[model samples]
Target: MYGNQWSTDGVVVARNGPSLVSYRFILKRSDDGKLFKCEAFDSEGESILESSVILEVFYIPKISFSPKQTLTVKENEQAQLICINDGNDQNATTIWKRQRTSTIVQNNCVLNFKNVKRTDAGLYTCIVDTKVGVYEDNARVIVLYAPTIDIEYFPSTKTMKCIPRGIPDSYMFKDWEHTTEYNDHLRFLATTKEGNNATLTIPQNVNKKDNNRERGIYICRASNNISSIDGTFAMQKYNLNLPGKPHFVSSTENTQYGIYLETTEIKIKFVSVPENTNYVVYKNGIKFTDYNESVLRNTKIIDTMYGKNVSVKGNILSLFVKLYTSEDFCWYKIAVKNVVGCSNYSIKLFSASLPGIPQILRAVPKQTEIAVLWNPGFHGGYHRWFIIEYRKVGDIYWSNQTTNSPNSTVIGGLQPVTIYLIRMFSRNRIHDSKRTEEILIQTGNVLMQ
Candidate 1:
């Protein structure tokens, strides 16, 4: 056995007796290339036998993470990770792959991602491979990204919602905005939220006054600590033609009649509230044919309740009638309708120049007086009165009686036993119309003696 004077560095030798020897040492990675020697000699210290041994140690690669802590990465950016080779064997090959799975990563110990996505976040393992065995450990990566937004419109609820998805499972609505075709911009203060989505409710009706705030696009903005994003929420348009009534504009009639033939033409102009739809025309309360006129194809704008502007057009209806008789006047009406409701405008086709003659004249004679009754006709667009004329038979002058009552009149102070002739006519502000047929009457004597 060698003596302790020749050995140190965690090495010990002992000789319990001349026939027994023992050696001990604690092996380490630094001792892989170190040499240990033992010699036996006579009592005079002559070299008898010598032997040496070289100690080689291989470690199981006590593995640890490169970052020693969790790694955090932003979405849609480049990322890379490394595994430090702290093993004594520098010739060992390095490998990287996903943890708890067989998905191996390329580029040896370094894990690389060009534009890492949200789905790429999870645990990754770094494996150090050597002839002895394989050593591995796990590391975590946290991917933080901006919010993603999607907008949905619900016609039944008259509402719009903005849905957002982001990392950290939290987000906020940044803006509620609007954009018009005319390049106008508007902002809304949105203070309401339900669950994880932001909602904007639409007004069922618009108050019409002007055309300043009409059809446009609605936008929703969502944001997180990383970034902000936007999406279209709704497109607003006004359809005043539904769930409302049509309006009356104006009406006109042109009439011409000879002794036999009469021709009447009517023109009625109307509009729908928020108007633009199919309409119907009526002649004497009966449905007439469609007369889709191109001359009145014009529209105007209306102010909405939310201060939006939209267009509504006026409609024109024309009806022409001809008959072989002179009394062929008519009543014309226009009706515009839709699924919401219906409305009408009407016109009485008649001339306003001269008042109509009285008809169905009746006379009741008494001893010294007479009474006349008649039915009235059209007023010719003016206030009218009836004139009754009476005279003795073969008399030159006729006495006149005026009555505003359309039904009857009375004449007193007539001579007894006298024959009389009478007639009636109607007069307006313009002039008198043609008189009715004459009637002959005889007054009775006093007491009929």
Candidate 2:
């Protein structure tokens, strides 16, 4: 076993015979696939023989995959993959590929996705090179998104859809219902699913309650394992029919109790009368449907209920009738018969005639007060005075003053640099006329007559 010398430094060389030599060294990852050489020289210091050998070192490349082997990401978010090699190789490169493509997308260790899209979902393979050999790994990416909703209406049905466009096509839905812009709940007729979409069907022949409820807000809810959302709309009818009904009440004294015996033309005013509408008058359970020119020509019959005439302008309907004391004790009603249907009867007892509204000429403002001038419109055959109402602009309450004169009056105790709204009307023994047209005025520095 005797070589000339058995020694170990960076490597160990042993010699036993004249022409026998051996070289040995510990194998390491850094020494893998390295070349080694030994040389022999003669006694004269001249090279005689030389030999060379290749060193083989073995090691497992520490392969690691980032973002795990399985992962999920939201739509429009960032995603990434990293392949790391912790082996003994100074020059190493990582290649990223999608699906089974052979092209290397990235040369660095990390694969960055600043903004991921729906088509970015798939398996990613990363190839890492090391001193030992080339290694590879895979990571799966998932993208989730909310459902998109759309609606369509037909002559006999309405269809609502909730469609999915993300990686996973699974979706759930809530029924249509009445909801605000914020909240969404499930409660409608029927729901069906096909492929990656959900649909809600509403038949036109639904119940009357449901039919009426359809005019309001309708909400549909769609959700998945990732997110929940809703869509809404307000249903309305474009074509409308049926005019609103009329309203009436007894006014001041003469008409307050009943029709006056001395009255000739009874002027009855009703509200809520739409424009261009024709109406029928009823007196003592008799319908006055005739618009005969001859009956209108006869002034004597015109003085009676048989000669009743109707006129509608804007929101007011005026009916002029002549009544006798015997017929005065009966009830009066009106019906708007033709367009769609007649409303219920609005009944009233004719006791007496009331005073009419006064016409306001003008309101003049002084330094600290105002002078209001007006003429009685139609007093309904009663003596009356003037009642003036005044208030500051934008004030909720009002102040009133009474004067015996029907023509004009002066109001004092006012302030300069102030604005006031004033209105005046005439009043008799029992009731007052509708207030006159409102007037606005500002006080000045000088008082006027």
Candidate 3:
């Protein structure tokens, strides 16, 4: 009886009851399949005829949130968000916005992030708007980046935890190690890296052999199995140690084995144990305390060493040594001393000498010129060659000529029957040898006589 009438209601007058009846109700998308009916009853109210209409409703569009409520990706990697929508409104505009800001990020059902970054992490809202109504939903975008491992010391708990800045959920703790000397002397420490925790408890209850085990540098690391950048695997240095003695450290390839005079210099760089280290240089077997000048020659001494120059930038002792004479080449040394102990180093230098004199083999005289053949003597640990000097027998002025080979040279533009004194010698970059014993020769008219 509630508004299911046909053609009339109470059958009074046009204004009150004789008006035709109709069914009227608010329609919505949910009411699209609802049925409405009208009935006409007989005079005795025994039989009735009914008419019905199934409602068809049209409404605005509504979008469904993507299945991935939260997403994670590495920096510079591609990522996207999809919003599935269902509605009858044809021109529905979908907009994606960062919930923290009023700016719209995307203008479609799919929100695309071609290159995701750490800053893109936050709640993103997808809004679908029709002319009649608007529908919106939110999803979280979690951008995963390279795991940055940082060591956090907890004094209260007496432990240090390796915390990853990026998505820790995806990263696993590798291990904790003592990197005091890097990998060569590396010792893996006991850590709480069983599950997701990366922590190290300073060893307290240990035997004598494990004394100061917690000293030196400590490192904790984590990784997400993906290495896209250099910082993907982090290695931090923490200096935790007791005082140590000074020592020398050598690099992989060092050319300071032997020192040769006038041509080379040596530089040694190294890091010693922390604290004030006193270095004393030695010459031969004597302590090189002050500068000493060699009147015979000038020699300079410079201090240099090599070791793990890390941790502390050890005190530098630079000595520049320039020795001009062969006698200046000798044993040099470095003495490193601290409160703990002393260390010493020594090096020997060899000197190069002038070449030896050359010997004349034979002489051939022409009408106005003469040629001399000679053999070069030992180089005496230096690069050298032969040279010839000659002059007229009675003249004091001498003429010199360089040998084409170590064994030959020529002297021309001479008088035909004149006597000449000739000699041969050797010369190096540093010095020249004494001339050999002089010999006399004569130039003749017909071929040399």
Minimum summed lDDT over a 10-residue window in model 3 is located at 294-303
Error of 3 at 378 (Å): 20
lDDT of 2 by residue, 65-101 (tens): 6766766787667877777767656776678888788
Superposed by TM-score, candidate 3 places the C-alpha of residue 202 at a distance from the truth, in angstroms, of 8.8
lDDT of 1 by residue, 157-179 (tens): 75778787777666666556654
- Model 2 segments beyond 4 Å from truth? 1-18, 22-62, 129-134, 149-161, 165-172, 177-199, 203-219, 225-449
- The residue-by-residue lDDT of candidate 3 on 189-295, one tens digit each, is 77786455577887653342222234456777677765645555655556654444554444311323223444344344444444434677777788765443212
Q: Stretches of candidate 1 above 4 Å error? A: 1-32, 46-49, 66-68, 152-161, 178-189, 194-196, 201-217, 228-305, 308-449
Candidate 3 residues lying further than 4 Å off, grouped into runs, are 1-18, 26-62, 67-75, 152-161, 168-170, 175-197, 200-220, 230-245, 250-269, 273-278, 282-333, 336-449
What is the descending lDDT order?
1, 3, 2
TM-score of 2: 0.41
What C-alpha lDDT, on a 0 to 100 scale, does residue 266 get in candidate 1? 53
Q: What is the lDDT of residue 109 in candidate 3?
A: 82
